[model samples]
Target: MQLHDSMIKEIEKSKDKIIENRRLIHQYPEVGWTEIKTAALVARELESLGFKVSKGDVVISSKARMGVPNQYILDQHYAETLALGYSEAELQPFKDGFTGVVGEMKFGEGPTIALRFDMDAIGLEESLSTGRGPVDKGFVSQIKGQMHGCGHDGHTAIGLGVAESIAKVRHQLNKGSIKLIFQPAEEGVRGAKSMVEAGVLQGVDYVLACHIMANEPFGKLICGANGFMATAKMDVRFKGKAAHAGATPNEGNHAILAACSAVLNLHAIPRHSAGETRINVGTIVAGTDRNVIPDEARLKIETRGANTAINAYVKDYAYQVIKHAGLMHQVETEIEVVGEAVGGKSDEQLIDIIGSVAKRLNVFDEIVASDDHAGGSEDFTYMMSAVQAQGGKAAFFMVGASPDGTGGIGHHTSNFDFKEDALVESIKLFTGIVLSLL
Candidate 1:
């Protein structure tokens, strides 16, 4: 399972193309289910590399997809991709939010190894201010209100590089198959479930995924992550009768009042003694005029915990508060579960393999079994849990993307940027992992 020199050379040769694709994806950032262009590029590249590519229903189960944008937004992004010079045929498979691709290359048979890379960007405007590398390099997001605030751009590029490297060394591989999964809508912990439900992990013997973290130094690498919180993202709406505030205040069921009550009480939900828990109402919208009682209100909320039971406890509490708040205010309430992730841990076996591979590569300056996870939620947990349920091993790790040791800028913000060289290191590690396993 030693990585051959040819594989390393192929990865080395792809450095320029890898960076080029990263910048290309970063500049035309798409969010969530609107990743037509990004998926198209990945599909084309994998197809060119002689891998069988699957898309649309084969790659994602439509009914399992969450937090999808409305048809109008989907069509708008479809048209935007077309305007970006991608042909309708090139973007066809990614239409209607069935975004992402799975590229498979089999060499006889052994164990099926899958590598996942997320492809969507956050809904944040790019910073035009100084010190943003994308701004200075003229690759800042061209799309308004959409930017690759995380290192998904780098991850996507690393996936492609690994694909090329693996393709080059296919002759040396005797058995097993490799699957490169380019996922979308990871920001809200969406996308993975649909693909998993579509049977992506059905035959996956080992599933490996990674994230580029700005908080870790450039040469640092974690073999696998820990403390992935179980989480649920929900949207709530309140409907009430509108009336003149002064003249008919009693007739109006205050939707905003119910929303405010729910917000305040949601935050006040007693923290579980079992583990860390979190609740947030990230956005709220209601009302039209000053004198008119607000008729409707909508809230985007999320709850997280160290495990599924704890998260369910928080969700249940939040739900009761929301329901009672609406009833107390005389407004009808509607709650929708949009996204969810269950807690998972990386397999110790895979972690050991990854740690060994990292040490043999002689690239990473720091290697650890696990790093500071801070109980974040990742949709990859869905796939990891799924694969493990089928008696397979799965691991999701983190690669340091900060070169200057400042850990780069905070993610999900306008100023987010990271050292691009992390792309090569990630590709090397991932490609090496594949060679070691397959």
Candidate 2:
């Protein structure tokens, strides 16, 4: 189905306004759960567009006593709370807090459709040089040490623009509901699960999401793509006896050595013949003193695959390695599962709808299918799982944002940037999806 010519023209007319919102959001970047300023701005804009909004708070509570023995108790309590399903409101009293907001546009009511956009930015310094186009135009991020290097600013702006445009035509929309979700903490891949548990997708018939691609050139958009990788995040800790390196070199169990062994072994996880798999030890900390055999060591590791079975196998093998390394080193070991994201496959039916809209809008020279999956993961898997669990279908698409006229630097990099024109194109795509699905 095609959008009315008037609606297309209206979207075109608001292109400048949408770009302005994108620039404003880019100027003041907020990271993860600490998105107060960003959330406030988004809520204000969403309210102005005549959408009812809901705000959610982080759920961390309980205080740590300042002392020796009590410190361990406090730390354990904190970790346990995180492990359990704590409400977002329960975490608000903590030093660093998280917040979530949802906007809704209710129309004639058929199948409920939802569109999600992440609102958090990464911690990266933006380039001050004029070499990045539009910098001289004052469209650069103003915040220091924090910038929308991940294109989330554009995503949020596009979501808001689509919400506004859709609200204007609510009377014409057939029987269905549309929800705009501006989720937080997507950087750490921690937001969507909690939101899903909170019933964010409850009563929703279909769900859609998109990430702006800094690789696709201007006027080009991708519809069907299996892009995000399945991911498993694990925290491994090894406990042993601490002793002086010189005086009691042989007295300690060498937890640090055990940690090192596990890290290396994890990286050596064999490749899967079925699909692409990767393992990495992102962070490791052990030994407090140069001359001491540390009693405890911690390693943050992640594994990814193109599909679910490989992801599961990689994770199991990694756990076995960690377990055996601790046993061999004679140190107590504990593995905590931090996060997991399953791979995503674009729905062929949804892809067809997107292609049809693109053809009708003449937005792309060719609507090619994409099979490249990024090693990065998204918590949207939680929502996708919930939808499929309830006999519903979902898919996420990539909108081109490459500003170099070709794919630019990878996402989350300090120099990551995208073509500004892609923002309006994304808005159009989202609008079309809502119309067709509803």
Candidate 3:
């Protein structure tokens, strides 16, 4: 699909503005459902540009929300962004404290197309060392402990840029609808399904979403990285009695001990011979003082499998381990599923469309015509699966951009970041595909 020369010029004009928007978002990184400032900015911009926009819980199913922060936390974040400049009216839709945006426009009657961009940051303390951190670049996140280590800020900016390019040519667009989905809580794989539950995929015909530099170099692009792994995120809590350690150690039941046991047993689970699988206890909290036995312990554990059956196998084993660990320590335990996603595959037909479009753009160092699915998981799978369930075609791509030449740093860590230039390529690539489809 060749983007008309005029259409190419339209996208070319938005390049600088796109990079600027990316930096603005990078400076204020918000995590998951707490994206008040981000969502508001997205909604306001799309609304001003003349698209019908939907915001907040209306885009999510409350009953399906999982692992949400407590109300106090949600309210605190909401207040913070409100103070940053968003008005109460702009925030009214977020009354019950959820955040996301969907901007849709039907330009004459073609197939309905959706672009998904995640709007969330990770819980990692960004680097501050001289010349080695985002802070040194002046666009550092103002919030102390949060960071946009994942290139999502770039993703959001690109989505907005793509929308603008598409809008400029609306007069020529015929026979199709376009939807821009600025999603939240993607870090934990928790937002997409709710939107799916909210009927966001109804009548949709094509879907495409991308993630930045999983390892590919700054100029390389993976037309389709097969698909990501199936995954399940769980929160476990163990309850026990607390007592002074020196006075009577036996009188106290240690919940931390139970958590430790579970963490070890979780890692000890046999690997799946069928395919790649992974289990990790990412965070653990328990105990106040070293002299006292902790009464409560909590764990943020996750499991991943290359496919549905393998993921199910690992999830079942993980649960058994959690249950038995509690029994071994004689403590009551509770478990809650925070999020889940089944493994997925890109539609080959759609992949070819994207590859052809990307080639004509004359950008990207390498275009991976095809590749194997990932060992990690992504909630975008939920949206893609939903679209496919209704006979629609879907594709997920990898936008490679690495500054140090090591493929952007580790995704969920403190040093993670990709070249902002990826945003430019993304805006061009995504818009090109939309033009071809429309």
Best by TM-score: 1
Off by more than 4 A, model 1: none
Candidate order by TM-score, decreasing, is 1, 3, 2
Taken over the whole model, the C-alpha lDDT of each candidate is 0.90, 0.75, 0.86
Between candidates 2 and 3, the lDDT winner = 3
Task: Give the per-residue lDDT digits (tens) of candidate 2, residues 281-400.
Answer: 988988888999889999988888877778899999999999999998899999876667777776778778888887877776657655565556787776777776787778777777
Q: In candidate 2, how many Å is residue 159 off? A: 0.6
Please count the clashing residue pairs in each candidate, in the order shown: 0, 14, 5
Q: What TM-score does prediction 3 earn?
A: 0.93
Kindly give the stretch of ten consecutive residues in candidate 1 with the minimal lDDT sum.
402-411
Sorted on lDDT, best first, the list reads: 1, 3, 2
Candidate 1: tens digits of C-alpha lDDT, residues 1-438: 687566667777778999999999999898899888889889999999999999877889998999999999999889877896888888888888999799999998799999999999998888899766887788989888999998898889989998998888888788999999999889889899999999888999999899888877888899989899999999999999999999999988899999999999999999999999999999999999999999999999999999889999999999999999999999999999899999989999999999999898888899999754646899999999999998999998998887467775577878888888888888888988888887
What's the distance in Å from true for residue 275, model 3?
1.6
